[model samples]
Target: MKKLLLGSVCGLGLAAGPALAADLGVPVRAAPVAVVVPGFSWTGFYVGANAGYGGGKFDYPFNAFQRQLQAEAPAIESRLDGRLGLTSGGFILGGQLGYLYQFDNRLVAGVEADFQWSGIEGRLSGTGTLTGTGTLPGTFSLDAGSQVRWFGTLRARLGYAWDRALLYATGGLAYGQVRSHADISAANGGTPIPGLTGGVATSHTRWGWTVGAGLEYALTQNWSFKTEYLYVDLGTSNVLSSAVDDPGNGFSAGASMKVTTRFHTVRAGINYRF
Candidate 1:
């Protein structure tokens, strides 16, 4: 009886072990490998559009302007000495193309070229009181104006990119077209004098340099937004005006004017990377 009982218990243990093993079997497929996405890169070619405001000051010497009248109308020139300076401001619209490369250490370097249509301009008129010998002894007036119709720049940029954000400093060659005009008129006690008016108008293209800084952010995988400020200098231009000649009054004079180009621009833009 004891032997039979022990044999039955061993048979039950073997049957239970096989049932547990089948229930705990391994999975048919391994867990999906973890997917890893890489960080953003600033290496690409891009094209963009921008809009902003531009304004600044200029250098127009009164002495240079008086050169036209100093010889024949010394009295008039002396009276018109120490004249007015110009102030400029306007709207700007443009587009840009660029290429950039970002290093392993997050240092970014690039080159960009941009073209713009500028509405920045300035105009002013000055009047002086004259009471002197052999002079009109009245009021003399002068009018002057300047405008930057268009401009372009080719610049190099260097920056450190913090993932999707970049801060940079840029500088390079700048060129533009400027239009200017100056006029001189006089009157005795506010009455227009005959043959006492002369003026000059000039339009020229000039080249110079620009320096600035900017901040940019990646808005999407292939798009970015940026804002920047630039200080641009396009040099100066000089043109001589027709001399004031009055045979009846024995008054003869000539003038030369100067137009200096310098301005500041603050702009915002969006770019698409290729």
Candidate 2:
């Protein structure tokens, strides 16, 4: 009886030992994943292409005689107010590369240069009455036709950044190139007679300043999107009158155009943070 009891105890011990070993063989649990926070180390270089609409207002200050004649001229008689209004809507493309310095409180300051190939233009017409011993009073009408101007800006930015989004304002130097044209005519008994048709093309690069604000949001670790508005004053340029000599006028008028352009752009771009 003692031998039989010993064998049964040995069998129970073997079975219990296998069960304990199986529990010990289980794999260890994995640690939780680490969250990646965007850092202020976006101090690398980047390039991007953007297309958006651009528009601006322009003023052409007239001479004393021109202003007086314009005021007295009938609205239907023909005249282009020396002002070019709200003319905007063009495609803009450019690239940017800059260095960003981040402070302890997440404020970022940087310098950037941006350029654009633009197509923005406007047209205006004006008529002045010609007085002489004619049987009926006649009118001399001068019409400024469609003129195209292309411009670009280079700026520096300062802003506060929140992880994947940045709200900032920028101001810096601006530059551009433009072309102008005009058409002149005379009216007899309301019958239009075309006079001098001439134009001038000028390649101008001016040193000006710009101020704008923008919001840039990150779409991915390597890509960002932005919307911005910039106000620019490209200083002034002289645009000579086209029909100065058609009627042998001894003194031809020269118009000084003071150009101020404001651009609002919405763009999507990709940047590789280094």
Candidate 3:
């Protein structure tokens, strides 16, 4: 009976030792796996403000204008000295609304609309010298002034984001209200002769287009700051005159004046993502 008990204990000990050894095999640890993606996100609406530099090309068509004066009266000839390329500097404050879509490959695309309040005032002036031989045999001089049409654009922005920063370009339709003013004066016999001197101020809301580029840096999870430059080309429009008292004939002739303007502006702005 004793020998049988001892044999049973020895067999149980051997079985337990093998079970412990098997449990300790390999010392396994779970391998690390991907759990999250890294990329840019634009899942909300944003707004901001910015300030910077603005410049561009400008032109006014005054060639036919002077010819018209030459044809009207042989003694009347007008020439413009500086009538275009007026540099401007100002500030723009506005907001943006848009939706962002991110591709699976980390490519982000968004469509946004922005409106700006502009302080952009551009000025151009000209000097005209008229010679009267039939009636007066002396040279008379006159001066001209400029006008500013203040307006902004509704644009769409397309950008590429690298982590927290975005490099982008924007373009779309632009519209604004422009105000123009001009002065015409003359001199006779070395004394100021107030012949025909007045100003025409007209405000018109015109439509055009704009294009630009910019860079933005993220300030927070839902906010960003940006500095951008835009070039806006508002084509020519005509300015007409209503019936009024005429200086020479008590009759007013309707004249169509052409206006063409361009601009380059930069601004720093902040945006909040919704």
Predicted structure with the largest TM-score when compared to the true one? 1
Cα lDDT tens digits, model 2, 1-274, are 9999999999999989868777899655689999996564444555565666666655554331121122354322223334544354555666666666767787878887777776666666766764433243456655553233556677788898788788898988887775555454555577643322334444455666778888877677666777777776666665544333222332222233333444445554445454
What is the clash count for each candidate, in the order shown? Answer: 3, 7, 10
Candidate 1 positional error at 140, Å? 2.5
Stretch of 10 with least lDDT, candidate 3? 62-71
C-alpha TM-scores of all predictions: 0.77, 0.64, 0.68
lDDT, model 3, position 133: 37
Candidate 1 local distance difference test against the native: 0.82
CA RMSD for every model? 5.3, 8.3, 5.9
**Clashes in model 1: which pairs?**
68-254, 68-255, 69-254
Q: Rank the candidates by lDDT, best first.
A: 1, 3, 2
Candidate 2: give the clashing pairs: 55-88, 78-127, 79-125, 79-126, 79-127, 80-125, 80-126
For each candidate in the order shown, give its overall lDDT on alpha carbons.
Answer: 0.82, 0.58, 0.59
Better of 2 and 3 by TM-score: 3
